[model samples]
Target: MINLQGVSLHRGERDLLDSADCRIFPGHKVGIIGANGCGKSTLFKLLLGQLETDAGRVDLPSTWRISHMAQEVEASEQSALDYVLDGDSELRLLQKQLAEAEASSNTDGHKLAELHERMASIDGYSGPARAAQLLDGLGFSHAEQQRPVRSFSGGWRIRLNLGRALMCPADLMLLDEPTNHLDLDATLWLEQWLQRFPGTLLIISHDRDFLDAVVDGIVSFEQQKLVLYSGNYSAFERARAERLAQQQIQFEKQQAERAHMEDFVRRFRAKASKAKQAQSRLKALDRMALIAPAHVDSPFHFTLPSSDKTSNPLIDLREADIGYTDRVVVKDVQLGIQPGRRIGLLGPNGAGKSSLIKTLAGTLAPLSGERQCGEHLAIGYFAQHQLEALDSNGSPLLHLQRLSPDASEQSLRDFLGGYGFIGDRVFEIVGGFSGGEKARLALALLAWQKPNLLLLDEPTNHLDLEMRHALTLALAEFPGAVILVSHDRHLLANTADEFILVADGRAEPYSGDLDDYKQWLLGFNRDKKRKEEKSSTVSGSEEKAPEDKKTQRRAAAALREQLKPLTNKLKNIERQMAAAEKALAAVQEKLADEALYSGGQQEEIARLNRQQSEQQELMEELEMDWLEISETLEDIRSE
Candidate 1:
């Protein structure tokens, strides 16, 4: 069990939690939820012992092993499988000691035997198979597992980190936004895995369906308190709404009673006969505080306005080939997106969901075939990349103003407020905003256009639960057609009317729901693996390679020897790059200090500036060297 007693936590001046108390029982799956920057991640840090509580105690079993997903990935050339295996630190340490024990002739035979016993006890021999299973489940193929971790994109690296976390043996696990980087399929797989985990699980996620499926209870951040609610996210929402409603009723009653008492006092306090009574009443009033109604305020609430125009078919694709100029991903796609149609795209990552959406949105023209659209087809396309395209220096109001120049400032502010940029926030520059803020602004920009057709790809990537709930409601009420490509199963299940599967170089309608699709995906992967294994078996049976094996070994040795220097250089540069980045980040943190801008800090400011400049230069130089070495290593491996 984990218990927090009267916990008070503060981030600078803002008190995240004040005298909050909560207890999580053993093997309980608790979903942590709140608005972004409401200290959900900070709670996880406190549990991980990375942050100390300001005032109160957190009690957990001292011997319980805790595991957590890493937020950052170091640039390393370690294979994905090896990196995941490293999560079992004890196993790795045992293996290392065992290797040394075997290498030393003077080592005690009993010590060597004891190491082997420990390895067997820990299932160390099956470590590789376990890691491979985790990798495959997390959407990595056999080839990709053998590939170095540095080769993956940021999202893929996040998946790798999740896989590593899952690979660790733990009594308690802390996962913060595990589904953020995942596609719908992988997210489903992870949900199933967590459901079967025999440990206490605490997850902070915005995906409601994920929490609904995986958690038995919820821990919500509200009114500077960690309130534990029984049941899943949906249950918590309904219960909270009901509770708040009841609270409002009681508060109103209390306010009326207090008003009556105050009015009586004001009218009679001037009389000498009632003066003593009025003084006593005033003392009683001083001891009482006005009951505040349960405040449930969500910073996000915006709807995608429907275009005034109408068309039966918003978009049509005939024999289309979707992809870039150099490659075609999905071919022979015949589809029509009609008005009021809500179609969700489902496929493996790297498959052609985004490509197909791009083609439909006209962001990428088809390499072959034709795309026909209605005369009034106006698309409000939202993609992950579109967030970056936002003008960082511009405020939310400015972005909206660029959309509708003739609109009044008050009208724009009203519109932006629904998307969570209320009051002075609407005028603040977006450069300092968080990713979730940018995503909301991007969506806000998309909403203001009043497009008839919405093509959204991973639209909820950075949105918090409240924002996601707001988006879900908005999308549900949207009058126009929507083609969504998202990893958020809850969003898809709630908004989409049907599923379109894009795979195997083609796009077609899938005659199944999300659950059915998940099952199909598992079967599809199994069939593919089986076929590959059969083909390998057949090819092996036909090979007469007794002598060729010796030649292959010799060539492998020669390649390894040739790549040794480049590998060493790559590791060295990676270390230097990491160091430079750490130093740069430290300087940047200091630069963020408000004191640096105050009077008499010119010398300190100049020193930090010089340090920042030097670190940046060093990082750039190391990065170039790292890239050159990586490319040379790739060339050697290709040879």
Candidate 2:
């Protein structure tokens, strides 16, 4: 178990934590959540003993092994698999000793045998294979795993870092935004992997769905204190909402009482008969503690401005091959984007989701296709690269001013404020901004142009929960067409009306939601693995004849027959889950209305709350069924 007692941490003048206390038990999975710069990472560092607390104590077992994902990796020629394997220091040490003993001029047989036994005890011989699996689950291909670590891009390197962290054996694991660099498929894979981990896990993440799926508890940074909740992110949200609602009620009542006292003092201060009463009222008012109003509002609040110009189909592509000059990534794609369309591109990494989006945004031209655009079509394309394109020397005000030269400075400042750039922040140079700030600035610029169509590629990469929620709300209200490629499931679920699967060198409609897409990915990956295994086996033994076609067909038919009932049940569960989610989303949409919280809507709010709980429970039950059937299906497929 891990415990922090009266822990107070200070960064510069900011008191990140003051007398914060929390305890995490063995084999517990907890999520650390808060706004950006809320000391989530700082707390992890404290656990790792990299930083000493300014006050109080942090306690843990002295012998417990801890593993944490590194934020950055130095460029090196180490193979990705080797880098991951290096995470197991003990295994590497044992292997080194064994090699040295064997290579000695006068070999010590007993020492060599002892080293080998120790290695075997740790299953070090299979380290390479295990590392490869981690890499594979993180979106690295077989050939790519053998490539030098220095050869991969920044994001891939981060995945390699995550793989390394998973490779390590530990009693406690600390993962900070483990899914930030992963695609949806990889995120799903990691979710399943983390679910099976037996050790105590503390993850700091903004992805609510991932947190809900993996973590059983939540440790939130509220004010300057660490408050631990008993359930997942959804539970935490509901709990916080209720707490804030109560706080609001108390504040209103206190204000009314204070106002009554002040009025009494004002009306009777000069009357001789009531002079003593007035003085007492004034004293009572002074002694009364102020109840601060609950601030449940998000710092971010903005809408994606849409153009007034009309366009039926914002963009159209026919027989499009989207990729680079030498190779086509997604071939023969037929896609048409109409006004008010909300489409999410889903697939494995390097499966041409970004390529397709780029082509649609007209940033990447199709090799062979007819790309049509509406005459008044204004495309607002946002990508990670755009964040880099921002002028480092320019301020948020300057950036917006360049976009709208004739617009008033006050108007631009107000616009920037919606993106959390207020007052002096709008004039601050962009060079010193953090990644999340840069991403927000880029988005603010995108929203300012009033585009008829928005193409966003991983726009929420560095955003926090508040910013993500704000963006989701903005996208939900935007009237123009949107083509989004995001790993954030909450954003996709709430904003996207349809999904397009880009995989196997083709782009097509995926007739299911994210949950169904996850199921498809599992089967897709299993089949791919089987194909690879078959290809390897056939190549290794050319002399052996292949299996008879009739026998192969019979075996395949038998497997399908065995899987039929389970597959059908899984599909039924998925459909029900989707329906439950839709209902929950509807209730949530109603709950999001500010008017519901204003006043005099207690009955309506209660009804919505009950409905939300029911839908959530139903969704949870269906998910459990889906998981059980999925596991059974996987077992059959493996056999």
Best by TM-score: 2
Error of 1 at 601 (Å): 64
Misplaced by over 4 Å in model 1 are 249-297, 325-327, 536-639
Which candidate has the top score in lDDT?
2
Q: What is the C-alpha RMSD of each candidate to the true structure, in Å?
A: 22.1, 12.5
The residue-by-residue lDDT of candidate 2 on 356-445, one tens digit each, is 888988889999988999888999999757888999999999999998899999999999999999889999999999888999999999
Candidate 1 per-residue C-alpha lDDT over 70-137 given as tens digits, one digit per residue, 9 for 90 to 100: 98898689999999999899989998999999999999999999999999999999999999889987
Question: RMSD (Cα, Å) of candidate 1?
Answer: 22.1
* Residue 608 in candidate 2, Cα distance off native in Å: 18
lDDT value for model 2: 0.82
Candidate 2 weakest lDDT stretch, 10 residues: 286-295
Measured on C-alpha atoms, candidate 1 has an lDDT of 0.80
